[model samples]
Target: MGSNAPSSAAQLAARAELQGFVQVTDSRAPLYARLAVGLADDTEAVSLLAAAPASARIPVTLFAAIHDLLLADPSEPLAAWYPNLVATPRTDDPVPAARELCRRRRDDLLALVTTRVPQTNELGRSAVLLLALAALGDEMGPLALLDAGASAGINLIPDRLRVDYDGHQVGPGPLALTCGVRGKAKADRLPSAVPVVADRRGLDLRPVDLGDPEQVRWLEACVWPDQTDRFDRLRLAVAEVRRTGVVVQRGDVITDLPAALAQLRSGHPVVTTSWVLNYVGEDGQRAFSAVIDDLGRDRDLTVVNYEEPDLTPGLDWSAELATESLSVLRVLRWRAGERSVEYLATGHPHGYWFSWLD
Candidate 1:
């Protein structure tokens, strides 16, 4: 039987047993995330967190520490584990063996109720660019668009709202945006062509169906708590998505991509995911790149990737702590044989940015 219900004592016992679980390094996540998850009542967060593999349990344990030390006793030094946690190096790690006995307990925790969440990650860039295209080109007219890694049909609703980019803005409009940098972008004043949106479809091997309320709610909770802007953006995006009939289907892109590409209208622009690429691993990235290289040469495609540029170790765990989103994201624009530079931005889960790609 699945462990989908646990008494309060069972939960506390589990936490106590795993008390030794501590953050090894602050490199992977920020203190706030640690605090939010670690210290916040596990009775409240455990259900959602339990969905993650046991290998992820220690992170949850350390998260509890953040709550205990920061919230419960702010004046007390977190010295016992702070520096050690931040300085410890990362390697292939796993949850302590003790977790195996908590299987049923973990299952029980995952059954909690959650909020409705929309599509997230770099796939969000596809819609962001469409707005940029209209805002920059001075056209709101319908534009043909396509997306890869369309996890759920949700991202297919990119054209339904107004957007503000780095201050200079546009939209179906009135969308408010705040940025960390200055210099108002030259945007949206012109009568932008109304996008005669001919098409918007996506491909994903394991596409999530937003139509399912429980699953959608789980997706919402999966969203990092600190990024409230993301929550708002998702709210707007989902509202539009609910009104549309955009479709997504199950299929491996490596084998089915050419066929999917064939469905796009000629001369129309295509956009794919920055977040999906990170999950593609080494060979998958090369193969996908090769496919795009061949297809992009003859098509008017703009692949906007809001992804990490390299595998180098250092990263801003602070933003991760704050928003549960990547703070520093490199935007890559690839078309034909050439790739041009776009500025890096601190990303939000919902599509807001503090920086710009200029």
Candidate 2:
């Protein structure tokens, strides 16, 4: 290979931004990431982070490998590196372990980070979706769900997770997920039971298979090392999936949606997505909307997304919370050439917490 490009200031700025994100929302993963970022200039870390292909979250994948190593062997060197991990967490500088892994497994690490997308189907995010479903409980009952970019389709089983809000609570499943309401969302709380989901299916370019150990291993690898709560929830969620697997197909969302829609068994059709539209360009986003619109010509369609306003048109509000920087989400219903938009909540990227708004 020719002379590799030098680390750029832009990449460093991004790393700084990511560090801030982890510092606020995460605990242990940030430590290892900080160490890796500090050492970026010395190695090809900057090049590796900056030169990522489409859908590949380089930083998440990079740390995921380190996290997996720690999980793979909860022993010295790696064991003490991340204290926040559920299996082994000890407060200590993980720089040495991170450096050693990067040095010894450079080629392997690069391959994992470059080839794979940071696909995480966290149980925490289910709260955000649940809140939206709660809001639409009366209007759409016994719902049929179609999730775009639904990796592993873990989220397709919303009814399986439990949520406890201020005055209302939903579900009593094995996960029993938790989410608190903030700001105006407190008033927007729904009835105890969200609209029961009739059936659910997901669309992904590369859908993960929980049956395959390799695929499941990659899913575990995508999780932040310190988020033991999510890790524990994911285990149950995966088990739930095994007991009742969801249908996640390998195809383009826009191209495959019509066919997928045709196969629905019953209930009103609702399309959902979160942290997905940002990856697509403006044209693709508009095309997706257009497809939904096309479908809306004859039948009713409901859409919801947690999205950054920069890419999603008509969603022109920012979170008042100065500390948190994440996508603003809302619920939309399209029918008879008309669309209705409503604010859902502002939340952490992983749905750790939600500030509900009307």
Give the number of the best model, judged by TM-score.
Answer: 2
Writing each residue's lDDT as its tens digit, candidate 1 over 75-186 gives 3334222332234422322222112212323433343311122334332453344444443233323444555677665555445545444444444632333332324443
Count of backbone clashes for each model?
Answer: 31, 3
In model 1, what is the error at residue 194, expressed in angstroms? 6.8
> Which is the leading candidate under lDDT?
2
What ranges in model 1 sit over 4 Å off?
Answer: 1-107, 110-128, 135-142, 173-195, 265-267, 311-350, 354-358
Report the error of model 2 at residue 328, Å: 2.9
TM-score of each: 0.58, 0.81
Compose the digit string of candidate 2's lDDT tens values, residues 1-358.
Answer: 2343345664554354444444544455566555654544434554455545534534565666556655666663765645444345556665666667667767766676667767777767778888777666577678898888888888888777777765467887766777767666544355466578888888888888888876787788677656667777787888897776688888777778888887778878888888777666667777787788788877888887876665554333334422334656677788676877677677776776777654
Candidate 1 least-lDDT 10 residues: 92-101
lDDT for each of the candidates? Answer: 0.45, 0.69
Per-residue lDDT, model 2, residue 208, is: 89
